[model samples]
Target: MMMKQLLLSFSALLVFLHFTTILAQAPAKSPAQAPAAQAPVLPQAQAPALTQAQSPASSGPANVTAILEKAGKFSTLILLLKNTQVGEQINSQISNTYKGLTLFAPTDAAFSNLKSSTLNSLSDKQTLQLIQFHVLPTCISLSQFQAVSNPLHTVAGSSEQFPLNVTASSSNQVSISTGLVNATVTDNLYTDSQLAVYEVDKVLLPLQVFGPKSTAPAPTAPATPKQAPPTTITPVVTSSAMGLIRHAALSFGVAAIAAFSL
Candidate 1:
């Protein structure tokens, strides 16, 4: 009876030991445990967009007509420019052909001050020449005029002597002298890489259009030479007076001596 009881106890203890080993081999999980942390989700990167300023810019200069219109004082000038073929040439020069151009624009008051028939009677060709006289084929700024020579070549292309003369004073005042008219720069209207517009108080009259100012100066120059001849005659007049005085004195002496002797 004692041997059988010992065998039963030993069998029960081995069975319990086997279950404990199996439990240790397997991973343990609890209801309160958290899941493994996943990598943080990140937003996808996008390409950067170009801004307005970064876009390509216009390569050409502004239209000459548009620029003149904005000035608000060149009504007559703008009208004349648009109507004439010379305007085409000037626009071409300002935008493409030439490096730039200098425009001497007369104000409305200046245009109004002209003789009643002055602008009214111009032939088409003459009108073209008149406008050409106002434009310089090359670009020139107010400061640059100080270095340019008098009789600067104009777009007129008439005669070499027909160029405009620029005179800039130390006070920074600039005047343009055409052979017939002298116009001073009243204000600087506009200046840029391709064009320069200067406002003038008087209309620029070309010598080619109006005959050279009266030859009155030519007559005055001769008057100077005539006055020189009068200077030469003074000595002759003085000599004649001296000879008359001597003759009178000699006659008086002879008469007085005769009287005394008698």
Candidate 2:
């Protein structure tokens, strides 16, 4: 009975050792791996919106009076434009038309160079025409003047009575000749796609308004007074007078003889 108990204890000890070795050889469970770190997401930048004032479309049409007013040295021209209401017309045309317009702007000095009574002499109708004479119906650039035909038509009528000629020299100088005055384009005051303003030395004088008058024939000298012819004297002989003289002599002789005899 002692040997059997000892044998049983030894077998139980061997089984316990085998189970411990199997557990040591087996793999152990690792802690769960932390998730990979991710980069922070950022919002994309956006462009700023344009305002009404800053937009190009918001700008209105060009103003002639305002342009001249800003340019200075155009006070007289500005006044005439205002008085004739032509500035408004030009502004309106610029805004409405694609054909465009060209203006020959006479400076204050240009107006001053005229006769003192020049502006005053113009009637309302004539003043309107005079202002219109300076404006071309179509826009013309400085370089384009060279290629244009002579006797260019103006906003004023283009009849023979109102002729405007533009001549450009090889030197790129432009000269404006109306029948009455020849003006040089001294400077370019302003220019754009629709409007071009040039500074002219003289106010363009249209032939219809300022042409020379026909002169009357000078008075003829009075005829000299003619002298009267002198009177002529003539001799006259009478037979009756001779007879009376003879009779008187005979009576005298008879009276003398009779007295001697007595």
Candidate 3:
């Protein structure tokens, strides 16, 4: 009985030792760690700088002649500018001396209205003066004319003799007067930093170039007729034959009575 008991105890001890060794070799179950947080990605703006650098700048003429050529109506004015050499001076002064320029341009029809002799009779110097009279040295807008001082000086250089009078009518029509010539702003052709061109109805003629003429006669009203005078009227009378015979008999009786009494 003793030996059987010993064998049973030894077997039980061996089983216990084997389970301890197996538990020691197994992996431990520690608390699980969360995955490392990823950084948030930011969006980038579009590249306008590269686009702007690649685009080409606009190229164009800044002179008055070039600007006028763009519009078709100023052909007549352009012709005159090229013919007179005033166009060169205008471009020079506007680019160098003056800050800006103002021009009163006439249309093809306006030039056609003039008599051939009017411009033909003028000498080259006179023609230049006439062209200069059309331009104001500085740029003047339509609104500026409304508030201008009387007798506005022109580029023509004769401030006293060739000055212009600017007036705005109640109807909103702006007109310029040079005594001999009166014209209105029919259209606005161009306005910019260096040039302003206004279309005018008539060609400007200065009194300095064209002398003064006689005044026009005033119109008269018709005369009325005179009334007739009043007159006194007389009635006509006829003598009767019986009344004449009675008067003769009475005269004979009176004569006989006078003889008897004698």
Candidate 4:
């Protein structure tokens, strides 16, 4: 009995001693351990990097004047737009009515041949219809103009093709297929004497109005209407010359008759 009691006491003492030793010893940890050990998990958040934004005008010519000014080639056209109330119509009235529209402005040289009366008439609402007829919905650039070898749409909602010609002079020019005859880009010290495809006449209409629901058609053209027609007509007048001829004829007839009678 004493032996069995001694065994139980030894077993209890061994277990207690073992538990005490385990409690006394320190826990093992890596030298690099952090507060993460105390917590079950960590929360994270994302941060974005800085970046540059596109400018308001990068998309295209925002307004009529903007395209005019930026396009160096259209400087004269820009000045003309500045002078005309049509520019205001482009900025305010026409632009408001038809949003996302593009216009092709003819230079002053284009209008020089037109009778002032006719040009004035073209400025009114009804006649302005003809002007609107010349625009395109999409923003087209000089390079885009070259991509097409056929007629295209205008911001004015009309279908007009541009004319590209290779002349004997080894020169190329642009023209719009339209009723009004025009002079293609004139060559001088200007433009490095290189040929360009701008209509001698301005294709006037509203501002950048191209949109999803816009009515204007796409100008698939290389239109350059800057040439005088081959045929020209002039009125003939000989009324003043006829008077002198008549007087001389009458005197000659009378003198002949008198000589014959004698």
Candidate 5:
């Protein structure tokens, strides 16, 4: 009975050892773990758009008629420019060359102040010259008139014939004298590097066409001397007449006696 019991205990002990060996060989369960951290997402960069000022449209040549029309109060001057086709010439010059231009714009009121027949009296050629007289070949500013020499040249002709003299006062008051008319600069209508338009109070009448007339004096007549009156001779003849009458009567008496004796 003792031997059988020993055998049973030995068998049970061996079984317990085998089970422990199996548990040691197997992998152990790990604690719960968080997911792998991912890199932060970043937004893609984009290109900036261009602004209006950064990309401007190409501009066209300056137009004198359009400028005067926008300013107002220059109707008569504008009409003259169009009629003479000077405005188109100005635009063409500005577009084709780097040369600048200056215009002296007379207001409608200024035209009204002129005589009724003033514009009508001018021929087509004379009207053209008149309009050209107001424009300078080069642009000049209000302040520049002070330093400019007298009798500035115009598009009309030479300075000797179409002289345009500009004078500026201490108060910056500018005046233009063309010998025939002295016009004041009332306002600055427009000014740019290419062109300048000044509002004048009167028309710029050039000396070539509007000079004064010369009158010659009349000749004097010569003087004449006075004549003497006729003299009277009645008293002087009285003594001679009485002597002759007595002599005639004595001769007659003698002749009568002689005849009676015969």
Candidate 6:
């Protein structure tokens, strides 16, 4: 009877183990399908857009549109912000943050110089190491820039100044600044809000272009050719060779006679 009871217990344990193994072998529901089992509900991709009231006052997406409209002089930039990707982000920041922003915006022609693949890399603005290349972090118009001597920090987040060169403001159409490339304001195209826009010769890159920041040497005034320092000369033969030599000899003889008489 004891052996029979042991056999029955073993048989039950074997059955339990077999059931557990079968359960373990079943396929798992992927993360994609797990929610379906939980709610039998609609997928997340179909979520609703933010209503006006739902948007954050400070960082709402509408701000992007406003920046584009305000900077209509930036024809090329307008199109770039309208790019399939990252355009909206750039535009939104410009709208709300324009109070103190100096955008080193590139012209469409500037971007056209780059290969399409290069532009593709800009799709992820957050990961872009080149933001400082194109943005100034301060409020500066073309006029105030003359007073700004140091390189300003750019939204691209680097200390790089656009060199200012105002040799001629004759046309009133453009202001010139000294730099690796000439920075000029948008000509004849002004928005209701006047932003000093410039079209640069080359893309202003991050501080890496200049390397690390250091104490800039005091700007020297534009150099003047200095007169060669007046040189001192030793008389090789003495005044004896010139008319002064005769005068000196006579004066010496008089001095000798006076000394003898004394």
Best by lDDT: 2
Q: Model-by-model lDDT, in order?
A: 0.78, 0.85, 0.78, 0.47, 0.84, 0.50
Assess candidate 1 and give its TM-score to the true structure. Answer: 0.56
Please write out the lDDT profile of model 3 over residues 1-262, one tens digit for every residue: 9999999999999999999999999999989999999988888878564311111232632566775686676787787788998898887877665558888888778888999898889899888898899988888766667777888788887568787888876554789888878898887777655667887889988888886666888878677677676675754333566788889999999999999998
TM per candidate: 0.56, 0.60, 0.56, 0.33, 0.59, 0.36
For residues 155-240, what per-residue lDDT tens digits would candidate 2 score against the true structure? 87874668899988766589989977989998776677788888889999998888887789999999988878767765556777
Local accuracy of candidate 4 as per-residue lDDT tens digits, 1-262: 9999999999999999999999889687668745644555666767554221112333322355654555455665565555544555555543344333335456555545455665454444534444544444443334344555444554344343222221212233444444333234332111101111234444432222211235688879997889987786666568878998999999999999999998
lDDT of 6 at 70: 63
The stretch of ten residues in a row with the least summed lDDT in candidate 3 is: 49-58
The residue ranges of model 3 lying beyond 4 angstroms of the native Cα positions read: 1-61, 169-172, 213-262
Which scores better on lDDT, 2 or 5? 2
- Runs off by more than 4 Å, candidate 5: 1-58, 213-262
Task: Report the lDDT of model 5 for residue 157.
Answer: 93
- Model 6 alpha-carbon drift over 4 Å, by segment: 1-99, 115-117, 120-127, 160-182, 188-202, 207-262
Report RMSD for candidate 3.
Answer: 16.3
lDDT of 6 by residue, 138-204 (tens): 5455545556645554544434333323332433433444354455554322121213234454444
Candidate 3, residue 247: Cα displacement in angstroms equals: 82
lDDT of 3: 0.78
Q: What is the C-alpha RMSD of each candidate to the true structure, in Å?
A: 15.6, 12.0, 16.3, 22.9, 12.4, 28.3
Tell me how candidate 1 scores on lDDT: 0.78
Runs in model 1 with CA error above 4 Å?
A: 1-59, 158-161, 212-262
Clashes of 1: 0
